[model samples]
Target: MSVDMYLGPSKTQGSTTTTVCDNYGNGLNSLQDAVGNFTADQVLRSLAYDSAKGYFKEAYVPLIQGAILVVEATAKAVAKLPSDYVSEVDSCDLKSSELEREIQRYETQIQGMQNQINQVKQLLPVSSERAQHLREANGLISDYTSAKAKLEKQLQKLLAFHAFSTMIFTEVTSLKSAVNQGLAQVSGGKGFNANKGTFSNANLNDRSWMDTIGKKWQDREKERLKDQMPNMDGLEYKQIDFNGGKVWCWVKKGRTTADPEDIEKSFLFNDWVARMLEKYGPDYFKTDREKGVTDLLVEQNLRLFEEVRTGIDSKTGKKLTPAERLARGASLVNSLAALGVGAKQITNVGKGKAGQTPKKPPIVGSGRKVPAIGKPKKTISAPGKKIQSVKGKPSKVKAPVKGTGKIYNANGNPDLRALRRPQFDEVLKNGFPDGTKLNQHAYNSLFKSGRKDIMIDDIIDALNSKPISAKPGSVEYINPKTNTSVFVNPTTKEIVGIWPASFKK
Candidate 1:
């Protein structure tokens, strides 16, 4: 059996022996016709058919391919007509989307920056607090160091006092022992009376008695040395209160209290010696010859003083060669004497003149007037006017009058004949003169019209048609409507009244 075939939107049944009729030709013709009426759907469907045929390797593929070819050719023709029209529409949509993304990104970035700034701002007070704490800690350390230094100085003073007290006690003990030994040697050879009456005779020179008296003196000295010993019995060496505390020590033949002043004097002397050794050398205190010590220094000082006096004397010397030392001494004495004398004279004068006031000088030439310094002389211009002068005063003169000696109206307008006609004509032709008046009518008209295009000639012609009778320098013009005098520029034709046309009169 035979059958017909159809494709696309129209379908037909066909015989088994004959394959589907190649309707792709009609499809291509339809595509070609549709190309003239190419809608987007037709183009998509044609492209799909070409893609299907290329995939299937069918014999009728040429028909589908031809459709693609026709569509592509038509598309190329459409493309040639300004691609920007399509691209511009697409680009505008793309730009809008891109702008939205950019704005969002910008806002996000701004928010992030603001967050970071806020975080940094929050840390400022904390950082400032830490810095203040650090400063306070540093100040505390400084105070501690100062207190430590002061304590060290106090400890050194205490150590010095302890050493001094110990030394004084040792010296007193040694003196007491020496006194005891001397008494024992004298007492070994003889025996003497132990009576207190033996001390009453000043000339009694018995050796035994002297030995007895010396033994007793030595005993008393030993007791005094013992009493003067430092009161270190119950205290540790470091804890001993040597400063301002009384120390009992044994001295020659008796117990006594050691003088705090004497002990302090010893310490002060020692300190002075030590300081002298440190500063000047150890040999500084070996001699008592002050004259020898001061001689060179005195000579040096004298030489220096002499040099200074010589310079002063040389600068101040008048006639004779100045004796440096003598001149300075004489000057000092004279200055002192002058001060005394001048003070006394001033006190004695006491609001009274020391000398008589000088009399006024007599006037010469009947006290005739002469001009004072820098004073301009006054002049009188009138022929019969007399120049007057008072005694001892300058003669007066009059000032010359300014101008052509002719008075004009207060407005500075000249007479009609005085106006320069040639200058006036030039000004009239060239618009307003350098200084000219404007009339009310022309002023109002020109300003209201705002007509800058009108040339100087136009103004001059307008005014020349009717010569206005007005004073020279007076602004005059013909009224545009009335053809009468209107106080515009007679010389130059510019509107010459008040400015700002809105202002009247």
Candidate 2:
């Protein structure tokens, strides 16, 4: 018999459910396929929409802004003799802020020019002399837009350099102090030890793993996998302090192949440290010099710092002159350009000649259509208590047309019958737009996997099967022949997850 283990109360903690599927892997595959189909453009638009709604500012900006101030203060306390450092950083910061105001003014002007062009096109004749008016208007907006873009590039450089200089000053002084104090020794406990490990040069170049780990540990939403999978006996839940934050973790019990100690160390070394560096640019810890520095988005440009500070290429052992390192480091704009959300390109300051122009990574998806995407509505339920649907205007769901063989209702909701594969894929890729919530575990398993082949359609298809009586506040939909099952949280009408029906059998 195949037994699947799920870790739950995921909603209150990580907001993610952990599922270990032991037998059939089809459920996961379907989700991977769906995620793979999302274009880079779609991802960018979704991010922009969320930002416009103040979601990112509310959730992230304060912690990061505060951290950066703290980091700079500590560096100043520990280091002495560089009279120019503080003055240079302050100059860059002031210039960047001014450039931002200039860019915003240009954006407003361009938008107004565009509106005028639209009006001219709509109300004017196509005569050559009149067309010149349109041309002048278009040309004006074009020139200003290009100018704004250049200012943006300049601003990015200032920020990147500011961050880079701070990192070097902080680390060099901290390392020296720790060595003198004999506090650079390796250690780990329930929390992380940041001073004792060596970071990969590769990590400095490609920190996408940082994003993966961030989603796994930080961006999770409330979800419980155990509600969907009952009578599972192979998993245990425990609490561990992850960098002073008490969070829940799941472990497979009696597993000889995987050591929990090794797993914890991996999290500390890779995930925890990555978060620290990305947030603070330097190590984040309380020191006699100052409280820990909290900042944001430094890991994005650490490649140049890593190479210059070490003075040799970790990969090829190529030595760079002090002048060469300074030149490359000074091209801060190239490094910072890759800092865009869902950036398609990266600035590679690798083995190339010092003065060689690095290729710029452009933000992808300009003028592409962004599909409407939103979060699923949430529902809450206490453990052991019956789950109930949210009280709202009842869903206006209707049945499919008789003998039409259609799987969707006229109102754009999924019906009880299985939808066509393409329709199913579209619905799942865009999220459960009919207000059905998807928990973090299910979302991450499908989209967060580096590569997979599952579609949301498969789970929705399984949901079309005959309903099974479940424990209070939950329902199970199963298709026996396909061995596909879906767990639904009745209280919120959320789809808890899709699991293999064979396990229940």
TM-score top scorer = 2
Residue 78 local lDDT, model 2:
26
lDDT of 2: 0.37
TM per candidate: 0.15, 0.20
**Model 1 segments more than 4 A misplaced:** 1-126, 186-505
Best by lDDT: 2
The digit string of per-residue lDDT tens for model 1 on 1-505 reads 1111111111111121012122333455575454334332334455444433332221122223333333322222222211221221111111222223333443443344344334334443456543543343334334333433433333333234324423323322433344344335334322222452111222223334334434544564564443232332222111011223211111222323334443333333223322332332212323222323222222222322333333333334533222222222222222112212211111111111011111211000111121121221342222443231111222222111112312254577543222222222333343341233444454334433333223232333234334445666655444332233435544554455422222332
Candidate 1 residue 322 Cα shift, in angstroms, is 26
In angstroms, how far off is 227's CA in candidate 2?
Answer: 70
Q: What digit string (tens of lDDT, one per residue) describes model 2 on residues 239-272?
A: 3333322223323565323245534432322233
Mark the regions of model 2 whose C-alpha exceeds 4 Å error after superposition.
1-94, 175-505
